[model samples]
Target: MSAARVPGYAELLTAADAPVLQVRGDWTLAHYRPLAEQVEGLRTRLGAGIRIDTEGLGALDTAGARLLHSLLGGERLAALAADAGALSGERRALLRAVAAAMETAVAEPAPPAGSAIGDVLEHVGIAMLTFRQHVVALAGFIGITLESGLRMLLQPRRWRPTALAANLERTALDAVPIVALLTFLVGAVVAFLGATVLANFGASIFTVDLVAYSFLREFGVLLTAIIVAGRTASAFTAQIGSMRANEEIDAIRVLGLDPIDLLVLPRVLALLLALPMLTFVAMVSGIVGGMLVCAVKLDISPVMFLSVVQNNVGLSHFLVGIAKAPIFAFLIAVIGCLEGFRVSGSAQSVGEHTTSAVVQSIFIVIVVDAVAALFCMEMEW
Candidate 1:
């Protein structure tokens, strides 16, 4: 640019007793700094029905068109550019292009302001929505499982006894040792705690009653269910989730096979058959543990422990704990299998769904157990 070139300027002037902006200069990149300053002050006159006169406007590059575009704004700039008498075609196109760029370009918006209460409410709302969606999915899975189970029951020839037996051995037989060991240790701990507490009241012998009542009513089935949920539920999910990830489930569908029969029923039937038996094993093992503790601490014999349990704890307490097993088993199996089917055909999705299955199974088991406890207490059972 020549040193004698006029710097861009927007001057407010009066014409016909109304304010007008007069844009003049070579608004090239070299003139941008001064032009920017000029437009900054003159921007306030915009939208006041102020007319802009670019009739004598000269030597505008994009930089200059930008300055004029801002001063005139989009509508006024377009009108000025549109007027055949106002500018040459090249200048008009430059102004139009600059105006289009200025108008179409947008800066990203800022995030909404947050307050303590608003953040808390937002989190609570999200949690509630997530929980609702989970419930809906669980209910749908349950419906599908029930329908499939009912259909299988109607078709006796379709029974897969081999699958049922294999699953039972895996779930029930394989789990027995761990279940017995854990319950036995827990029972001994419970007895020891009971003896320590009751001894202060000179009622240490009631430790048998304490162990029996707790084991028969809650700990037996609850522990067994939790163990199964953690162990077998994860297995179920990983097995089926891998199937989904490998497209094996898809292949099964293509082959007109019902995966519910080949996969779900076997696991579901196994757990249902296995859990109650494990509950029984848990109860027996736990009572044996309490018996050993009683014999050691209170000098009460195993016979006395048995006698106290038989006399004081009714059959109903055992029934109460055992009755919840099938429900827990069904929920655990269905949740594990449902999460498996939810896999998004990826290894990562399989891993995620597997973990989800375990968490959901454990959570549902605990919730059901708590609700049953409340109901049984209210019923005086």
Candidate 2:
């Protein structure tokens, strides 16, 4: 094998009228480091009448040409090629191409400027438009999903019991411990706060009513739905998005299978089944936790707690909370599945859609719950 070639070097010479820089040797990537340093040093000391002599220039590559062009200003570098008459034809062409590329890159138009308030307004307007588009798309997806679900409902043989059961196990059974634990802790905290505050008014017994009303009318179902939105919605998006990225969804379509029926329906049905049950579990667990706190801190017996809950927190509150669950479940599932379907054929796309599914599900759930609460209040439910 040939011995490794010596890297390029530069020599600076001062003349009567101007300074001259002589470049030599194999100016390729292998010889780049020292050449770059020398070029940078020359750049700082470069004067108005400086000239580059490339008579000894050898084995020039794009990297070396770019380095040389960068060391000299663009117009000045072109002048060097014209005046020096020493650069080889190939090296001169490379320098010109690099100079042109640099010029194009630097020629990008400046961003428009505006007042801070105007900029803020512009961003808000764009956000509102994007949000409108998202709402329309999601509404369309929900309609299509509902139509598909109805068609499957009318066909007994089309029901996917196996898939539904599997999803139920994954979404409901697997989530039970965490859901119960979280609600239990939240319930205990609420009870403690109630007892402490109501004690000042000599109405510690009212703590039972507070715990029961909050859990049954809001906390139980709302907390359950939020958890489901984060866990199950993201899972659905990731699973479906992966299928899309791998072309599994396309294969299903080619096989004359309805992607909505085979993939989305079972998951949606399972969530619809799971969420209400989870909410019920959350209610029971949270109420029990509150009862324990009341018993310990407020001298309220379990019997007394149950009696107060029954008398003061009516069945209507429980019914109202439970009614919200199925609606929330349907929205979460549809948003998840819809975002999944939107994923392009890339891992990054799957990841992006998965995150979007979680955010959209949680946002929609909160908005729907708020609207439902206002409607319920207006109706005196």
In terms of TM-score, the best-performing candidate is: 2
Candidate 1 lDDT, tens digit per residue, 81-122? 899898899988988888888888998899988999999999
lDDT of 2 at 315: 90
User: Candidate 1 overall Cα lDDT vs. reference?
Assistant: 0.89
- For 31-126, candidate 2 gives per-residue lDDT tens digits of 888889888887888777777776676677888777878787898767765653676666667778878887778566798878999989999999
C-alpha RMSD by candidate, in order: 5.5, 4.8
How accurate locally is residue 62 in candidate 2, as Cα lDDT from 0 to 100? 83
- Candidate 2 ranges with C-alpha deviation above 4 Å: 1-106
In every candidate, how many clashes are there? 0, 0
